[model samples]
Target: MTAQNLLVELFVEELPPKALKKLGDAFASVLADQLKAQGLAPDEAVVTAYASPRRLAAHVTGVLARAEDKAVSQKLMPVSVGLDASGQPTSALLKRLGALGTDASAVAGLKRAPDGKAEALFYESVAPGAALAAGLQKALDEALAKLPIPKVMSYQLETDCELPGWTSVNFVRPAHGLVALHGSTVVPVKALGLASGNTTHGHRFEAAVSPVVLKDADSYAVTLQGDGAVIASFAERKAEIARQLAAAAAKVGGGCQPIEDDALLEEVTALVERPNVLICEFEAQFLGVPQECLILTMKANQKYFPLLDAAGKLTNKFLVVSNISPSDASAVIGGNERVVRPRLADAKFFFDQDRKKTLASRVEGLGKVVYHNKLGTQGERTERVRAIARAIGQQLGGDVLAKSADTAAQLAKTDLLTDMVGEFPELQGIMGGYYARHDGLTEDIAFAIEDHYKPRFAGDELPRNLTGVVVALADKLETLVGMFGIGNLPTGDKDPFALRRHALGIIRMLVERNLDVPLGSLLSTAIDDGFGDRFDADVQAQTHTSVATFLFERFAGTLQEQGFSAPQVSSIRFDTSVVLTDVPKRLQAVRTFAALPEAPALAAANKRIGNILKKSEGDVSATVNESALVEQAEKDLFAAMQTTVPAANAKFEAGDYTASLQALAALRAPVDAFFDGVMVNADDPALKANRLGLLKQLHDAMNRVADLSRLAT
Candidate 1:
């Protein structure tokens, strides 16, 4: 089969900036996949995706003009039913053959095959290949149907003829043109009420020509760039924008660079076809406000990339990605600066107004705002958090730390009433910190208030200070306990309150900071002392169990994600007294122990011992009577424990878990011999009890760091 590269493009109005990249990729991949499925393109065909503000396109190499014919064998029916005893075709066989465009004369060519217990007749034939025109039409329809459109717009297209009727069309944007070319020949295909052609329009304002005519599949991008004044490839255009942003920032001197935000870069890439990076500036007075507020407003509201100095502080200058390049760029820069000045002024006004009333004065207003209907107002939640924070701080530090935590927690949610935070809700903790410093509060409290929401998402940094860690822990714990208490738990992916994030935050604090606090004890304090009169006694106990289970499940998943084997994580039993800091060490010890040569035998023996203990008639104690040991194997096992148990226990007590587990390697021989020679279920009751007790002691010693039986498999 002769093959040639293919090109397809859909030109439309400006697409949704965030969804353009995904839509473009989906369009190209789906089109190529459908072509491959229809045998019109080879499996190893190279697919290149091109996207701009007004276009989605793809170029696939090695696309055949028509798919190759394929040999196919299809099962017809049972041989006995298809043929009579006289060796002639039955009416049913004739009818089935007729449906396949065959007749009774073709019966002799059919082959018989056994399909299970019964023999069935099979028909073999060569299926004709699909033409590129039909294959591409199917691919185009499937690609358009599978696009991840954020929203669809329905528009009416006027009939080209004098029908005087409007045809309704639905698409992400209004499609103005489509181009499909197999090499240099135009492929006849249609989409969104438009016929495919060899030409496409681009650069709504700066096109070098009216219609960019593509000469071939290979020339589409170059031709579009030269004649249309547009960059067709999304990745190439984004790289160009980034390069220009860097150049523009460097031109402003002072070691300035555009703030690094890939999402902002992608959005800007989707909003422009030519991508002219221009440096714009606002008044220096606006820099008095926190850079987070200014940078956020510029990026979020205006899609501008703000420049930051060497110290990572926001400068008055910012970069804008304009769609058109003019001989004199001053007008565009001035227009953007004028448009952003009012936004920056609003942020400044909010900041100045919020500072007039200190965070302390705003604390009382939180009562009016409901946090959750079942969990009371933000005022009550703040009180609970303060109580929890004080308790955790006292345990971590002394009275001074506790007082600081309480003060920080008291003012943490006061930012909810701030004008700056009200305008930008994402700046809640951030604005609180600024206000705290302005109120003459200590830096410790200010940082604590600001960082109480630290580690909001995965890979985010933890709280910077110990005070912040304490408040963050308390705040997360209070939310977890309160939500679990009210039976508002996360189901599937619908975590409306971000309880999963809050749980992970608590885990990170305890483990990363090595807080040395028992997770159970913290939950107990939060439940018993923090939320006063909120949950009843029964509800409190149930909530503790539910929350603990949920946290342990999340912790286990986290350990697995960190590259620990499932059995290793499973061995470290998560319980009320399990300290989060100790889990990783224990898991490492389990991993080390699992690598020993005697590990498998010991693990298997430990598993057998567990099964034996579970099946024993009465309660089996860890205490073994040495005098009752009759068998030689049992006596040897008991002697081995006398020296090994104390040494292992000492290492365990000293926190040398790996050494502790390694000590048990000496007993593997004795354990194997005991299982081989000893009869655990003796006819004599006292003898049986002694053997069971002996096995119970061995199991306890082996599982101190982790349950060794989990490593058996």
Candidate 2:
């Protein structure tokens, strides 16, 4: 009945930096969740997670020492089997009672209840609740088993005789100690062959005390920070590091700031217990290399944040987050600077050596590099992209654009053969742009080489110029059409080739750029020209539809994330012939039209017409027969359509989709009247066919911008 806070800690060797945060979160949440499920912790209990390089811990408040006992009802065998016809206890009843720790004397206490079609006997009793110690042990076991460890290590425990022991244990790292406490009392739990205790070792070198003793669950963080020379909370440590980084950057002046990278910040936080940010500098000469090369080298190789000036240019100085703080920080700064010199030097070397060879010369080497076993070498893929780019460029512009796009696509992938790109694959297209300038190539070609891989991930910027756009479109299409042709479509969550990203990139280019090129035409060009004879004839024939569907699905998902409702997207997406560039205009028009007072009635009428047309046997004509229209409602609707259709069609042709859809709002009254008074399925076949034809014309006019029926619900 009494409640107390709980603390748990697992001390081990250094954990994987990238996985430490996830492991700590999982450990705390799972342990707390298990306690709540077992009734050992209330729903209002607060849980705090702590993670460092050497430990994973949690502090939970308002945990019950033992869960409350509860009454339970358990079903027993049928009454017929438990007792004879006369209602006397049978041997089976006695055996069942005995198994339940009772005897024949308790048989009379059993109750009979109807279960299904038969009467069944039931036993009722009180079940004892779980104690904190046993519950914590179970929770601990479950948490450890569920950790998202990147790799597991196996080690043996030492024995008293100092001989190698045979008790092997597997964990993310070798476990050395464990601490579990309820209030101030040590909980009797064991894990990884270690008993629970109140003391834990802290920072390897800077701890003010050898072992930090926790007084209570609430005091764990304070004690660790004061005596252990460590910040226990992962979030707190990251924040402290960020604060120090900002302060340090401010001290540098000139509006200089440390480069912002969340992942790098988290990784550094996981690598230290006590963070101390110090400034370090490299020679100004190293800045001659592309700042991307220098910054990446510092972050990836040294885990440092390169400082940037007001103009967003990387400076020679950088910030280092060290685990130790000393009275004088000069030695740490000097040592880090010394260590980073070779990394920057190596990047400079790669950059210098790479520029010696032109991208055009590197083209021959791509022939030897395999792109995919099924897709042939990079040389062949580049040729495909070049052909596609040229075709797209020709369609969008004249011979000038086509020539630029072809040249850019031909040289785009050649950077993969460069030393800089080989060492840093993230800089593939980036290095190509730099090398193009060094080779005295035109700016358009150089930019196209770099921007061809634009919008590589979500939120990334698209190609900056027309040549870049043409090449990027060509590059992505080549991948999508080729892969789809090979039957390598993405299945649920398993996109090994990142075809989903490629498709989204294509969609973004088409929709964002508002390119006039048709989706089907682009696919056809990429297949028939880019990958001629590379795939089976049947696969080639189906590639356009399959790839277009995949791209449209990605587009629909994008729209949903942008706050468009599913039905709104569905209305436009249902038409495969709908131009990708025109989708936004059409969706905007639909949204605008839906706000009109007539929208609801017109949508419902359209739905009715759609259902009637679907069930009809023969093809319905769009031309209405005025002579066959006997009802005034039908005649008025037909007259309205004739007048409205011309105006809507003109606006639609002028690309004023919003205006086009808004023009049809006048028909809502006549549409409602026609549906209310007219019987579309008449007794006479000619009259019925003519009425159906009238509705068909109305449906076509209403849906020019979007399928209005989708808004009915």
Candidate 3:
């Protein structure tokens, strides 16, 4: 196969950078799949995509001009199945052969079935070779015609574009022009009725006002910077942003690092055809306002990256990235500065106005903010969070810092009403901490008040502070139990309350913090305490059960993430009644133990013992009758268990699950030996009863460590 490079670009006015990336890759995958489906694959294909706000370009290398021909799979009736009583082909089979362009005279012998089924099989498919490049061209034209250009619009003039008169492109921004090329040749194709060509526009500012006729793909990129205004790559744009921020901060001697806002960087990166970083600052008086207010103002209102000093203090300066190397750089900077001053002033006003009222006073305002339409107001929810935190704290003992939780809960959402948080919603927790400290709250309480929202996204930092961990648990606990009580569980895409996040947060707290709150009992207490005066006993019991199942899912996921095999974790968690909050840690121990060579043999022995003991399920416990015990193996097994039982209990009491499992492994040898040497189902009634009793003891003892028989290595 000869090699060729395919270059295609859709020039747009200005696209959402994020959306452009999705579309670029989407178009690449679509084209690749289409090519393969048509059997028109090249020796190797690669699509290099680039997009700025102005354009989306995907260049496919080693392009095939056509798709491979598809061999039709005809479910033809075999001659054996098709023949009538006279042994001649039936009229229906002849009609089918005629429809498929096949002649019965050239038919292969009837395929026969050697198996039991009577229905005969037919001939498999084979493809005849055809022009691969022609197939590719046809498929390419069809795909481009149907290419998903969402948010497309039409203009009156139609130059053979896909739509009548004018058409919309598959983007929020307008698809101004497109360039398509196959190696050095222009692959003449049309979609939306527009013909494919190598003509492109340079940077909307720098290049010719009209479309550019590019000689080739490589020069197409380089020429855009020199002639056109477009800077086509996100990587180049982001590097420029970083450099500018560093340079700007250095000039002020502010000693700051860029905040590294991924979302802001992406959005700003799109806005420029060519990116240049510029440093700017606001009035020093504006610095008196909350740092969050100034930061959000610049980033949200002006697309600026806020700089922070060495101690993580917010500097008044910001780094603004621009797309165009504008003729009037000063005017662009001045206009942005002027636009953001009023936003900062509004934030300061909200912050000052909020400080006048106490957090406790703001609690009343929470009543109006709905936690869920079904779960009542934020005020009610806060009460439950505080109550559950205290209850869980009691179970966890000193590490919970219950008093700190109570204080934190009081001030947690109070910041929701503050000017800082009102203007910058992301600063809710941070603002709370600042206000708490300003109000002379204790350090633990203030930290908890802010840190309760930790582990915001997957792989984000967890709350390491003791007070914060407790309060965060309390917050999630309340959300989970309260939402379940009101019947608003997450399903499909309908997590109106974000219960998944709350559950995930709870898992992180338990697994990472190693808090030993008896999960089952803690949930029960939350249920009882949270709805002590409201729900009936029956409703409370059901709600408690539901919440337990929810927590179990969270624990299982957390355990699996920590490297426990899913099967082992699931089998251990099969029993819903056993609530393990620190399940991930325990499962990790179990997995480590299970990985040892001894585990499989031990598991087998336990399963053997379980099968024997299951027969004695409803029977009365066999009180040992030394006179009735006839087999030496049975006596030895009983004696072994009696000694192992006390020691196993001690290890379990110490919460050393690993030691407990190891001690339980001791039973494996005796139990297996006993089964080999002794006949558990003996003819003699007295002997049979004694053997079963020993097996029961074996099952009961090992179960204390874990239901290990169900676990798989």
Show how many residue pairs clash in every candidate, following the order shown.
Answer: 0, 0, 32
Model 1 Cα RMSD, Å? Answer: 1.4
> Least accurate stretch of 10 residues (summed lDDT) in model 1?
528-537
Note the Cα lDDT for every prediction shown: 0.93, 0.91, 0.70
Task: Arrange candidates, best lDDT first.
Answer: 1, 2, 3
Relative to the true structure, candidate 2 reaches a TM of 0.96
Model 3, span 73-178: residue lDDT tens = 4556654667777777777777767776666763454444433445553544467543434544565565455555565554443446566565344435555566
lDDT of 1 by residue, 33-69 (tens): 9999999998999999999989999999999999999
Show model 1 residue runs off by greater than 4 Å. 160-162
Which rank order by TM-score, best down to worst?
1, 2, 3
Worst 10 residues of 3 by lDDT: 106-115
Error of 1 at 306 (Å): 1.4
List the pairs of residues colliding in candidate 2: none
lDDT of 2 by residue, 1-713 (tens): 77999999999999999999999999999999999999999999999999999999999989988899978777878999989989998898788888889887777888889999799988888889999999999999999998888998899876535675668888999988899989999999989888899999889999999789989887999999999998999999999999999999999999999999999999999999999999999999999999999999899989999999999999999999999999999999999999999998999999999988888998988899999889999999999999999999999898999999999999999999988888899998999999999999999999999999988999999998999999999999999998888788888979988899988998898889988877888888888889877876787878878988888888999988987888888889543466788988888898899899999998998999999999999789877778989999999999998889899999999999999999999998998899889999999999999999998888888888889899998
Say which prediction, candidate 2 or candidate 3, comes out ahead on TM-score. Answer: 2
